[model samples]
Target: MTETFVHPRAEYIDTRQPPPPPQPPPPGLAPPTSPPYITSGTEECESRWEAGAAMTEWEEKEVEEEEEEEEEEEEENS
Candidate 1:
């Protein structure tokens, strides 16, 4: 009797019910819309990010070239 009491309980797994459907928003308030200004701002941000990324890539290549030149100079001196 004690072993059966301690065994897994199927009733616990069967008890859960699906959630009810969501209620609609109230009638008076209109659904939110993205304003033109907001979209324009987003586009500006995207362009700026692209430009910044390109600049960073160019800078990295420049740095690598400088390092290579320095290494060549050291080798020539040695």
Candidate 2:
């Protein structure tokens, strides 16, 4: 390696869904009795491909508009 310094460059990313609607806390939710996030066996993979998912311009615009309308409605009600 010519230079030993490591650098990172970031890029902007957009999602298809309008960050899923937040759910209100349940009056009384039960806790799971078992442990979670324990993967028995798995393989290292090219996770980057997921971010490359395709989204048409129309779909993106539709979601953006829907989100905006929802925000406007909430603001008016509040």
Best by TM-score: 2
CA deviation > 4 Å runs, candidate 2: 1-53
Backbone clash total for model 2 is 0
Report the C-alpha lDDT of model 1 over 18-65, residue by residue, as the tens digit: 898977768996765656466554355555567774435665576578
Q: How many residue pairs clash in each candidate?
A: 0, 0
TM-score between model 2 and native: 0.32
Report the lDDT tens digits of candidate 2 across residue range 1-78.
Answer: 598664553444554677878676677966543355534311111222245755567656765787999999999999
**Candidate 1 wrong stretches, greater than 4 Å:** 1-55
TM per prediction: 0.30, 0.32
TM-score of 1: 0.30
